[model samples]
Structure formats: C-alpha cells, structure tokens
Target: MNRPVRTGTDPDEARARILEVAEQHFRRIGYHKTPVADIASELGMSPANVYRFFPSRDAINESICGRVLNEVAEIALAIACTNAPAVEKLDQLLTALHQHNKMTLVKEKHMHDLIAAATQENWSIIKAHTERTVTIFEAIIRAGIEAGEFEVEDAAEAARAVRSAFMQFFHPVLIEHCVQHSEDIEADLRDQIRFILKALRKRGSLEHHRQDQDSQPIHG
Candidate 1:
C-alpha cells in the first residue's frame, strides 16, 4: 500500500520544496495575502508541521526571494564575462537588471513592507550580493582596458558607474513613473547604455596617452 507523505522531511529538502511552492503562491497572490496555511496545503502538510520546518512566513519569503536574486545576478555576471564585447556586456547587464528587479517585486512584495526588518536582520546578505556584482564588472572593465578595446580609468569607479546606472533603471520610484507614463524603458535603456559606456571610458586620458606615445623619441 502507498504511504502518506510526512512533514519535516530532510530540512534542506523541505526548505527547498517550501521555496518552490512559495514562489508560485507569491506570484499568484501577493505576499501578505499568502498565508502559511496556503503554502502548507500546497505542500500537503499541516500548518503547524510547516512551521516546525520554517518558524515564520516572512522567513520563508526571504529565503525564496534571496534564491531568485542570486540566480539573476549569476546569469548577469556570466554574460558579462570578458569574452563579451563591452557593449554586449552592457546590454546584457541592463536586460538582467530590468528583469531581475521586476521579478523581485512580484516575488518579494512582503519584503518591501518589512524593509526595516530585513535591513536590521539581513543586511549582510544584501551587501554581499551587491559586492559580488561590483567585483564581477570590475574584472570585466579591467580586462577591456588591457585589451585596448576600452580606455577606462579606475575600474572600481567604472564598475560603480555601471551599478549606479542600473540602480536608477531599477529604482522603485522611477519604476512607478515608468508605469504611470508607460514609457518604453527598454528603448531608453539602449540609448542610455551608449552614454554609460562613453562616460566610463577614459576620454581625455586616452588622448593624452596617444600624445605621449607620439612624443616618445625613436630608438632605432
């Protein structure tokens, strides 16, 4: 005879299953409206049993949102590898930023309401992920400058520029503006990508380098 499934399955397995179910629930119904019982029913467990595995609903929500954000950042960093052209990487970064933030809203709306909680309790995860993205782009910028394809000064600052541009693109207030005006953010982003890259490149620095090289005495 087939047996009934049990609660508190391996902790890791149970958490993963909970997150998978929560993603759908949060997407279908906003976070506040998605009760622990709803997720438990979907997973074929009693509400108390689910709680044994996850102490609180907000905790479960944070785990699922963190997982999705990491996946999106990994994909963006992979496509931003040095083998890709700067322009190509820029476009990938912009696309990833837009899609990631959009999905982040849908998946973790509760986290927004609980921002103070997360900032106090979970800020390290946030800082670590942001640092990871900055480091990845810094590597790409340094590589491009060495290759002579890009004339960039201060890879650190350049990385920050890319990060800041994306920040603006994904800013919540600006997102509301975009929704209200129905502006084509994608089209605007493409235009802004060029401006971002141009600003990052060492404009006058490159010209000065060229002048110095031309002035060098020939050693025949």
Candidate 2:
C-alpha cells in the first residue's frame, strides 16, 4: 500500500512566521533579551528549525528592522504622490518622518533600540533604507525645480544634503537623545525645515515665502 507523504511548511511562509513571532516577543520581552529559543518555542518549532530559516538572531532582527524602515518609506512615498506643491510635500514628508521615528521611540522602545543598534553597526539594511529615502527626496526636489519652487542645480546632491542636515530628526539614536535631553525637538525640527526651504527656494520668491509665513505650524 502506498503511504501518504507529509508536506512541510513552505520556506517563505515559515520565514515570515518566524519574523512575526520574533517581533511579538521583541515587543513583549526586550529585543536584546528575546532568544531564538523563545521564538521557536512560541511557534511550536525547534531552535534548529528556526535557524534553518534565519542563520542567526541578528539576521532575524535585520528583517524586522527592514520592515519597520519600509513603513517610513511608504509614508514618504504617499506624501510624494500627493498633488500638493513639491515644497509643501517636502515639508510634510520631513515632518511626518520625524514624528514617526519619535513615535516609535515612545511606543516601541525595544524596536527602536534594535534599529538604533543596526544604525550604529552600519547594517546593510540601514544603507538600503537610506538610499530609498534619499531617492524619495530627490524626486520631490526634482519636481520643485521643475515648478520653479527651488533653484537647486542638482536634485540628487540636494537630496543627500537634506538627509544629512536632518539626521538629528531622522536618525533613531539622535532622536532618542533629543527626547531624553528635553531639547525642544519640535522647534528645532521646524527651524531646520525652514532653513532647508530657504536654501532651496529661488532668489526673491516672494510668493513661496509668503505662503510659508502664512501656513500653520506643523504639529507632531
């Protein structure tokens, strides 16, 4: 008699399941304290089996961190696609990104710590995420240039500069430090954005200047 074959879980599904369970544990227990064994046990699998999907705990953390970064990227893309003027879009995008990072630090400290460590370690995922964010900035800058809103000669270079200048607001580690030190982050963020906009605006663009002056201050 022929015997029925036992089917194993799909590799991709298993990997995703492992990430889900690991993230839950990272949230409940701290990221540094959550062991692969705990994740495996919760998933009803052996630690070795989990290892088959992710070579090490750090590898799993990298995947989870990537997902978190991707959410920020999505928010940027959504703002970029809006019909609003490029200048306004850039303002909103930067503010939204900063607020998202701050929210993560307040609500998900463990996940924030994981990403901060990844940033300090110069992880590949961090590099990739930075590139993605810079690309979004470049696109917005290009649109602004086309609309005579910005006088920058090179969108790509300007985008990189913007990213560097806003590091304190965007970087997880720096954001946390600002929060801990009670350094009036919102005021600083607004000042930084205004400075960047001034640098990007065309000479004597009174209309944009007036619009910026009239616009309500960004909150959060």
Candidate 3:
C-alpha cells in the first residue's frame, strides 16, 4: 500500500506565526488593547488554536516583546565585537544604548506592558545580552588597569560598576523610569553613564583618562 502525505502544520511553525501576528498587533494597539481574539483573527487561526500554541494573551505578549529585546541584543553584540579604542567604544556604546532603549523598547507601544511581559516569562535572551555587556566592561577595566590608565584595585568590581551604568538595559527598571519621566529619558541615560564612569575611575590616574580625543587604550 502507498502512504499519503500529511497536510497538518507543525506545532512550532504555527506557534511562531501566532507570535508574529501578536507582535504586530501589540505594537499597533498596545498590549492592553490587543486581545487574544485580535491576534487569532490576524493570524487567520481560531482563538482556541492560538491558545494551544500560547497559553494566553499574556504569553503571546511576552514572546512579542521578547523578540524586540532580542533585536536590541543583536545590536549590542555587534558593537561589542568591534576592537575600537576603549574611549571610542564607550562613546559608541552609550549613544547606541540610550537610543535603542529609548527609541525601540520604551517608546514603542506595550510600554509598561513590555516590562510586565519580561517579568512573566523566562528572560534567557536578555540575560545573554547583559552578560555580553559585562564582558565588554570587564575587558576595558582590565585593559585600563594594565595600561596604567585606571588605578582601580579590582577589575571585577570596576566592571560591575560600569555595568551599573546600564540600568535602563534591564526591562522592568527601564519601564518604571520611562513612565515617571518620559520627557527626560536622554538626560537620565547620559547622567547614568557619567556617574558610573566617575565611580569607575575611583583613584585612577589623570594622565590617561578615557577620552575619545586620546584614541589610546588606558593601559597600566
């Protein structure tokens, strides 16, 4: 006997389609406004079927916002790979981080919904992002210490201090700050970077400060 071909779709592919539709809906209508039915309708699938893939509208929302977070991670990864001078890298990182956090994640609809989304589910994707950022800061701190550029006692502690400059990179805190002062987001981000850098330079030498003008790695 000959066997017939299967016509049914894969569960994973169907799930991805549902999430894709939900993401667009969320961006256009905000999380509260976009219901499960709306996502099902947009995906041309039954609401129950969509539910089968994602347990609820909230789950779908997490996947949606998580996708955006992944995009931000992609940008950070690309920047982290560049071997530019630490000062130039620092400048590039701050500018990119501020604009991405402010423009892509915060300003987009889901706003607070996105923060809630992050809390509701696994955040392995964003975890990878923070790790990457920390690695970059650690490398710079060690480089500075070796080059006699910075006089820090511990590179690991200094790296953590530098990482603190990016509180906005974490979703929940970012949303809360944005909600309180959406108007002054840029100022807040810049001030945060400035404060962290100042703290990082704790007892560091002045001869080789981290400056784009110098174009030199701060080596001990």
Query: Which one wins by lDDT: 2 or 3?
Result: 2
Stretches of candidate 3 above 4 Å error?
Answer: 1-7, 105-107, 116-136, 139-155, 165-192, 201-220
lDDT score for residue 146 of model 1? 79
lDDT digits (tens) for residues 1-220 of candidate 3: 2111121557777777777666777777787787787766666666776777778666776677667766766776677568765544555666576566655554674654664456545555456656766776677667766765556788887777676657564455564667466676655555566566566554543324434324533221
Pitting candidate 1 against candidate 3, the one with the higher lDDT is: 1
lDDT of 2 at 195: 85
Please give the range of 10 consecutive residues that has the lowest summed lDDT in model 3: 1-10
Q: Name the 10 consecutive residues with the lowest summed lDDT in model 1.
A: 211-220
Candidate 2 lDDT trough over 10 residues, lowest sum: 1-10
Q: lDDT: which candidate is best?
A: 2
Q: Flag regions of model 1 displaced more than 4 Å.
A: 1-5, 99-125, 182-184, 202-220
| TM per prediction | 0.71, 0.92, 0.68
- In candidate 2, the residue pairs with backbone N, CA or C atoms under 3 Å apart (3 or more residues apart, or in different chains) clash, namely none
RMSD of 1: 9.4
Scored by lDDT, model 3 comes in at 0.61
lDDT of each: 0.64, 0.86, 0.61
